[model samples]
Target: MLYYTIWTLFYSVNFHTSMVIMFSHINHKPFLGAIHDSLSLLFL
Candidate 1:
């Protein structure tokens, strides 16, 4: 159960990171910094 939980968390973060990257590519420059902040928040 613990392993499964960890895997899920990792997967979610990875997916979110990819989505954020894609959005940053197509969106404004400000959004890139905003997502970096968000990703740091997620890590914490």
Candidate 2:
């Protein structure tokens, strides 16, 4: 049970870090096309 709890915590932390990196990358996009595509999906 202790191992399972530790593993879950590790997995969640890793996932959150990766998501932050991905959003930062998307935010840094140099082209409007990419931003437009994402925004379209978001508003739809």
Candidate 3:
């Protein structure tokens, strides 16, 4: 159930949008924060 929920949320954003948001976020943060942000994004 949880996995499906996550997948649905991810799909709703789609791939390219996710990548664009991810890179934009990575650009503003420090290295550690970027790593954290990236991991968080991936899980979502």
Per-residue error at 1 for model 3, in Å?
33
Candidates' C-alpha lDDT: 0.81, 0.68, 0.71
In model 3, which residue pairs have backbone atoms overlapping below 3 Å? none
Off by over 4 Å in 2: 29-44
lDDT of 3 by residue, 1-44 (tens): 99999999889668746665677675975556665666687799
TM-score of 1: 0.65
Model 3 misplacement above 4 A: 1-26
Where is the poorest 10-residue window by lDDT in model 1?
A: 23-32
Model 1 per-residue lDDT tens digits across residues 1-44:
99999999999989888778776776755776859866787799
Report the CA-based lDDT of candidate 1 relative to the real structure: 0.81
Better of 1 and 3 by TM-score: 1
Q: Which is the leading candidate under TM-score?
A: 1
Listed per model in order, the count of residue pairs whose N, CA or C atoms clash below 3 Å is 0, 0, 0
